[model samples]
Target: MNAAEIARDVSARRVSAAEVTAATLARVQAVDGDVGAYLTLLGEIARSSAARVDERIAAGEHLALAGVPIALKDNMCLEGARTTCASKILEHWIAPYTATAVARLLEAGAIPIGKANCDEFAMGSSCENSALGVTRNPYDLARVPGGSSGGSAAAVAAGEAAIGLGSDTGGSIREPAAFCNLVGFKPTYGRVSRYGLIAFASSLDQIGPLARSVEDAALAYDIMAGYDPMDATSLDRPVERTADSLRADLAGLRVGIVREFDTKALGERSDALYREAYRDLERLGAELVDVSLPTADYGLATYYLIAPAECSSNLARFDGVRYGLRVEGADVRAMYDNTRAAGFGPEVKRRILIGTHALSSGYYDAYYVRAQKARTLIARDFERAFAQCDLIACPAASCPAFVFAAKSDPYSMYLMDYYTIPMSLAGLPALSVPCGWTVPEGGNLPLPIGLQLCAPLFGEKLLLGAAAAYERATNHALAHPAQIGTVPA
Candidate 1:
């Protein structure tokens, strides 16, 4: 069931929260071995939380998420649970407090089933970078689920949870959602609080949701968004309920087609799917307008420089002195060096080195400073595009889920975000929803393709409404992986 259905059924007393929670946990236990979506399972806490929801329902108090089971990316802290960000550096570290977003979910009666696995410190395109384990795609176990929020997307796609929280820096949430056949949302930069979420590129990272349906994603986003005094970057504006704004008709809505993106660059199947999605939108009464984001061509380059630079600064806190892994050495300098070398994975190390070099004295102006200017240009491009349309639509990724080990080089893997990083650079709200499925040349099973809709800053309601309308018309969100039925009853 989706979050809305679960909440209604639980509140109506047709099914108890405890029963739902147990069924969710049982589903995880039965299939997680093959899926590897979680870093930590909070079975006891989930049951206890569900019981509280049932008690509230009995007391005639309505809860938005009532008994819906959810999964959080490991980077978000939940007091008393290990928040590793899927890195060995903080493998044994337990969070002292819950993230504001997570706290809000719990208050709304959503049960957190576990901390979902992710790329180490949310750094990789594939979950293989996780020190904990690789999260396989439910559609094809031999293929990747996409990353750093791959686990969160996989859990929702596999029906292990009703909804899942994911952090998007440069397509972390959307790429995974595209790969796993789920809806992923990335709100405007300051729309959601970052407090208690372990930083990974402070400027670029935004917490969002991955769910099987648009309404579920909207529900999760509504509960998690709003100002938090604890997070200085949090927006002070009044929270808008995206779920309530969902509309079935798209009349008068002008959707922009990005002229900057080359359809020839996308796989044949993916390109075909996106074109069909465009036609579908036109049929639904959305006017299609051509738009261009010239600076978007430099998005990947800009994101790499800016994100890594921020990551280098944020991750500095994990040094041997304060907490996390501490390796003994002859002196303090050696200790710091050794500890980091041992704790960080290969991908993390590469990014740190690249970031440090880019921020170094002589190279700062050449790389880091230039990237900031490019970022401003990217933002401007979006501003101009938004003037032409209510939302901009494009393929979520250049291709669907790739088999594990398909791209061994880091640069090749980075290309996975080719269609997604521009919006992140602009700090715009974007949603990725399944548009269709594509059967690869040699692949026996069809993998999902996603259509990404980007809106102006703080325009999540408009973005979600269009997606919800598309979902209602196509019912693509209802498609599940073949493995979904394999979970034990």
Candidate 2:
């Protein structure tokens, strides 16, 4: 069920919050063994939290997300709760303070059932990089749920959580959501505070919601998003008000299709899905226009350089002397080397080395600085496109979820996020909504497809409205995976 439906039922006394929470915990217990979706399941705490929300509702208090059960990505801080980012490095760690987003959700009466798994430090595109183990896709257990927000999307897809909080740097949230057939919304960069989120690529990261439905995603977005005094990059404008202000009518909405996105780069199956999605949109009374963002050709290369460069600096803090895993040596330097070598997974170490090399003094201007300039030009390309159109529509990824074992080369795996990453660099509001599914013969691969919608910065309302309309037309969110529902959870 969606958050709004749960809230309505809870408020109407149709069900107790404790019951829902218990069922969710039960679901997690049943499926998480195979999925690896959650890092820490806070059973008693979640039940207690739900009971309190029920108490508040019985006491005649009004709350937006009352009795809605949600999960947190392991990367986001929760006071006194373990926040590991699915890394062994922080196996013994717990946050002394809660993130502003988590605090807001708690205040709005949302129940956090557990901490979801993620790629260590949110570095990899697939959850396979997580120190915790790969988060299997709900649709097909043999395949991976795309990451680093893979666990959050997987939990929601498996109906273990009504909503989940995930941090998107590059395509973490959106790609996973697409793989799992859920709605993933990433607001304009800085629209949500990054203060307590374990930084990945600092500038590109933003906390957003994953839900089974578009409206549910928007509702959660409204609650957790806003300016916070603690974050330097936080925008002062109100995200809730901006989202609420979105128009429902599509009559004058200009939807741009980046002609470049529909190509061989997306592969045959994915390109066909995009074409089908556009045809469906055309039938929905929306006008489609072709547009170009030529510089987007290098989005993958640019993102790899910029995100890792930033992550290299941000992650330098966890070198044995800081909050993460510590190894002892005769001196601090050896301790640092030992700790990192042992603590970091292969993927994290690879990115760090690549980032360090890119940012080194002699190479900075050529690789790092040039990438930033290219990023600026790409942003401008979007600006030029937006001037001619109110929104842009495309596929969320080049392909649907691939077999987990099939991914070998790091660069090839990274190419999956190519379509979605450019928007992150531009700091625009982008959402991935399920378009349909492809039932491939002889492969048990009933993969989900996502249609991506992007709008100007802080234009969530427009994107949400479009997504909501498309959702109604398609009814994809209401569809559930076979044998997965409120069976136990």
Candidate 3:
């Protein structure tokens, strides 16, 4: 059952909060060994929270998300919870304060089942970079569950949690959601607070939800999203009611298809899938028009430079002098170098070095400044495109879920996110909905594909409503991963 259905069943007294929480916990225990979704399991805390929810329900008290079991991405802080970003550098660090999102969910009576694993510092596109272990795709154990929000996506797909929270700087949230055949929503930059989230690229990072359906995702978003005084970048926006916005009335919804996203940019199969998705949207009363976004052509190049430059600065705090693992050396500087060298994974080190080089005084203007200019143009492109259309439709990523070994080459891995990085640069609201799957028969691996819907800044209402409508039309939201014993039949 979806999150809405589960919450309704509990509220109507058809099921108890304890019962649902137990089922969710049991499911996580049963399938998590193979899925590798969670970095920390909060069994005792979940049960205690479930009991409180049940008590409130029994007393006829109102609760927005009472008894709903959800998983949090490791990057989000939860007071007293072991919040590791799947990095050995801070493997033993426990959060002393909770993130606004996690705190809000708890206040709404939601039970946090655990913290899901993620790429170290939420840096990689594949969970393979995690210090804990890779989070396998629910559809096929050998394939990757997209990252750096891989575990959050896998947890929702495997039914270990009703919903999960994930962060997106590039396609971290949407890519994983596409891979796992779930709904992932990335709100406009600053639409959600980043005060307690482990920083990756502070300028572009945002927190959102991943769930079985768009409505569930939106519901979670409404609860967790809002301005937090602690976060300087957070926007002071009121929480708009999204559950009531899910309607199938797309009478004048103008949808644009970026001409830049041609077959040449994406491979043959991906292009075909996108064409089919456009047709599907057209059938749903959306007018699909070709729009030019020249800046999108340089999305990858700009992202690589900007993201790493920011990462290098943000990561300078971890010097083995304070929190997490430390190594003694000949001196303080040597100690800092030795600790970082030993603690960070290879991929993390690579990005840090790239960022450091880009930010160096002599090279800053050539790399960082150029990337920033490109980013400005990219954002302006979206602004121009939005004036021509109410929404934009495209493939969520360049391709479907790839094989475990397919992304061993860094360039190939980087290219996989080509279609996704643009929206992040623009800092707009985007949603990824499961369109269909590739390798549909004869093999255990079913490659899930997603159709992305993007809207102008702070236009989540339009983006999420469109996704929910598409979801209801195709019944993709009801589809669960096969072979996962925890998934509902």
Candidate 4:
């Protein structure tokens, strides 16, 4: 069952939170070995939390997420869980407090199943950067589930969790959701609080959900989107309930198809799939129009600079004197150097180096300031595009779930987020909904592909409304493609 149904049934006493938690735990145990979606299991905490939820229900309290199981991307802290961001830096460090988002989930009666694995420090495009364990795509174990939210996506797709929390810093959430055949939603910047989420990039990182459906994603977003004094970046505005208010169709709405984002360049299959997705929108009453984001090509370069610079600044807190893994040195300076070198993965080191150099005195304005200027331009491009169209549609990524080790070179891997970074830079609400499947020439299993949809700032209401309409109309994820080789695609 999805989160909404689970909550309904549990709240009505048709099922107990304990039962749901138990089954979820069982499923995690049954499949997690092969899938490796969870870095640390919270079965004990989940059972206790479930019991409390059931007691609350017995006392005549209705909970928004009664008995619903969730997987948290390891970066978000949960008191009892080791909130490792799949990095050795905090490998076994227990969280001192529950994240505001997580605390809210508990209050709503959601069960914390486990902390899902991710790229170390949430830094890589694929889960391969993880120091703890690798999370494979549920559909095909040989393929990646996309990163750094791969574990969260894999957990949801593998049925280990009803919904998974993922942090999006330039499509970490959406890409994985696309690869895993789930719906991933990244709220507009500050729409969701960042409290207790280990910072990746302060400006770019936003915590959202990777769910099985748009309704579920909206449900989670509705619950999580609000002000938190704990997070200065959190918006102070009141959030409307999006789950109930989803529009039936895209009547009187305008959806933009970007002029520069050519899906045809991705190849015949990917191009055809996204084209059908656009047609699906048109069929749902959306007026498809042409729009252009002229600065979009610079999104990746801008993100690499800005995100890493922020990462470099934010990560400075992990000195040898403080928490997490630390190696001893002759003196304080040497200790700091030793700890970082031993703790961080190669990918993290690479970003730190890039970021440090960008932020350094000599190159500060030349690179960092220039990137911020470029970022503003990207946002403006979106603003111009939005003036012409209510929303913009594009491919979530250049391709679907690729085989492990497919992108060995850093530059090639950086290209993975080419389609996703611009929306993030604009700080706009966006989502990737499953649209179709593709079986690469040598691949036996059909990999999932996503159609990315973006909305104006704080325009989540319209964003999700149109997405729900299109999702219902297409249900592309539900049907598999025709047989490509030996098995039905």
lDDT of 2 by residue, 235-354 (tens): 998655533544444666778999787655666766677777776666677788888999998888999999989989988988887696898888888899899888888888888988
**Model 1 C-alpha lDDT per residue in residues 96-144, reported as the tens digit of each score:** 9999999999999999999999999999888989998888999888889
Task: Specify the highest-TM-score model's number.
Answer: 1
Q: What is the lDDT of residue 249 in candidate 1?
A: 78
RMSD value for candidate 3: 1.7
Question: Candidate 3 on 1-489: residue-level lDDT in tens?
Answer: 788887887878788888888999888878999999999999988999999898888899877788889999998999988887899998999999999888888888788999998888988777888998778888887778898899999999998998989999899999999888899999989888898998999998999999989889988888888889999899987867787798685667989998877764566666677788777788888988888899898999999999999999999988997778898899999999999998899888988999999999899999999999999999999889988999999888767666677788877888867878999998999989998767743455557888888999888888888887788888754454545654752
lDDT of 2 at 376: 97
Q: How high is the CA lDDT of each candidate model?
A: 0.90, 0.84, 0.86, 0.91
Q: TM per model?
A: 0.98, 0.96, 0.97, 0.98
Error of 4 at 9 (Å): 0.6
Q: Which stretches of candidate 2 lie over 4 Å from their true place?
A: 240-249, 263-269, 440-442, 479-489
For candidate 3, list the clashing residue pairs, or say none: none
Per-candidate count of clashing residue pairs (backbone under 3 Å): 0, 1, 0, 0
lDDT over C-alpha atoms for residue 99 of model 3: 93
